[model samples]
Target: MKRSHSNTGANPDVRVRMRRLRWTTFSLVAASYMLAFFHRMAPAAIASDLQLAFDASATALGALAATYFYVYTLMQIPTGILADTLGPRRIVTLGGAIAGVGSLLFGYAVTMTEASIGRMLIGLGVSVAFIALLKINAAWFHDRHFGTMVGLTLVLGNIGSVMAAAPLAWVLQFTTWNTVFIVLGGVSFALAVLTWLFVRDHPGEAGLPSLREMDGHEAHPPHEGHWFEGLMTVLRNRYTWPIFWMNLGIGGSFIAFAGLWAVPYLSDVYGMERVAATQHTSLMLAGFAIGAFSVGVLSDRLGRRRPALISTAFVHLLCWLPLVFALPMSLAMSYSLFLLMGLSAGSFTLSWACVKEVNPHALSGMATSVVNTGVFLGTGILQPLVGWTLDRAGTAQGAAAQYRLGILIFFFCVVVGFVGSLRVRETYCRYIS
Candidate 1:
């Protein structure tokens, strides 16, 4: 009987092993997200080539780029629920497979309509990756480590964004854009297989103990509310709404500008060569990667979120004013200001911590997705809105004027985000363990 008890006790050690396994699984999941970022933003990297090839207008190109966000926004709420119900392992695997096919189709697309279809599929497939990873992290690691972990993951995944910029440009120089996407699609499919073979939903399910349990930390049992009720609870929570709006405001505009229009704004308006414009884009992405990782570490160390959130938003607000008011600046001045824009824009990195803090442990996936949905949805909507404004103010010489209007709109978003930040109660003071 003592030996039997000993064997049972050893099960916890196995569960502990699964915690390490979760990190491995998350790394692959993060890789898949990087692929999605690559494909999602690749059009921008090769925007000039795409425009010439397809005989596309700036507005048409903007719409094409925004297609991913449209499907991505629509998928978030449902994907959050699915992640909670079906678990990250399976959902991410399926997402990877679907996204892989989408990338392949996108590479093969002969018409704008076909390309749009591919973009939509990619959005649908990749939507689950981030939220699922967040769910796994929230479940597998201590809450105290959540923000830092997410930041690290984002930094890693953003390597794809870096690749999407200049490297993608360099690739396009040697190969047709279609071939680039075909290879990306195949890679995504392989990642799907890896995720399926290795990832487990939680440490317990893998015959291992939860991280908290192993560390003498008490585990919070997963929430068991009806999905609808859980969602409603998330919606009704006062804290959740503030973060959601904050993301919609600041995060939306940041993504719209940085992800889609920044290249065009630089090339067409600022008179930089296509290659130089792309390099500027790369610089912004690099800054974002650095800012996100740094903010995550600092937020965790200080044990406070509000100061970081407020400071970043205020800086972002200040940054937008320069871009809107100062037009046709020298290339050096524009690039310098854009670097600051990237740093300030990265303020939304704090939204993850804010979302995690306000919700029940089990609801982290849903809560984070809910806020993220706003960001992507805003991206989808604003891309076209900015494009339309630019089209209306049409002329190569007038591009800066139109861009100024778009930047003003972004300024409004930053102000609203600041207001939302004020409404949120500081959650860093609360202990999650």
Candidate 2:
């Protein structure tokens, strides 16, 4: 291949500068991604405080938490489109601003309605972060390194989830949830400013050669058609739909449980204290972070996608069995199960790489976003449905029975995901379309 002018005569100094600028850009956007994870999972830690503050029922509480997923579900495709069209830098900066305002509003709200609106805004804002981040990764990193980069992204973002778990519970001992959210809102605003000042969508925007060009390969061409056409192309593909279903089943259930119900389930069913319950969630989130990073790197190294995904999905489904049966578990057993559940749940992270690989390289954002929609959609439906199940089962049946019923919903979702995993196409760690 003839070296493009962009890459020709690119000396060691220029390559070194490119590396610094890209990493700097990635870090700023990633900080925003971290805040998004924190907001997504925080409701679980503060479930009781929300109930008391809003005088909310279990159903209402579920609705309030699901509000985020609902907006997130609706926004995924649009965010993907915007990521491809407007670029990751602009959308992520805007998303951070919206999320910051939402957090501030949520922190200050006194009424249930106000809180719900604030939560919705938070969802809408953070919805852009994941797709935008994925687009950035695809643009900045080499094709072979895509999975590892995504894994690293998940590792960093899940740190926010880790913070929202046991750490938030511990913080509650000394401070109100309101104060925590307010401080987070300020952090979100700061991230927005940093993103605007620092992030570039790709090396091209910074007047540098693409990673591929630096590696002596031609850079992938920019999209030549309308955004809608690109999106339709992704949608029209048969491979894309399976990933959506897989995500709906696995990813949705993970967030629905950990985001709002895990703390309550541990507290109600096991009669554990809030802080103690959060420790389990923290372990789960940490396991998820580790598992995500590990799975991505492993998938890249193994040069295959399906085997890891299938094995993890199978294990994830098996881990849910004890929860559905409401079996007795020692403290050690409980911790082990939650951690294993999280590790196995990491299987869903592969869906992004799988979906992207099966689609046109130019439509990676849309492809990943399409499948990402299933995750939030599943969560939106499952969260409220689980609550409704609990409400209908009522305290008359006892907390254990009620939660068992709620958990069965998750069990069903896991089964669906497992089946989807079996159907997933192996991409051998490269784009096929």
Q: Write the per-residue lDDT of candidate 2 for residues 312-419, one digit (tens) a residue.
A: 999999999999888999999999999998898989999999999999888998999999999999999999999899889877887888887789889999899889
Candidate 1 positional error at 242, Å: 1.2
Candidate 1 has its poorest 10 consecutive residues by lDDT at: 1-10
- Top TM-score prediction, candidate number: 2
Best by lDDT: 2
CA deviation > 4 Å runs, candidate 1: 1-19, 327-332, 429-433
TM-score of each: 0.93, 0.98
Q: How does each model score on lDDT?
A: 0.79, 0.91
Q: Summarize candidate 1's per-residue lDDT along 56-130 as a digit string, tens digits.
A: 887888898899999999999898899888998889889988888888888898888888899889998998888
Q: What is the lDDT of residue 178 in candidate 2?
A: 95
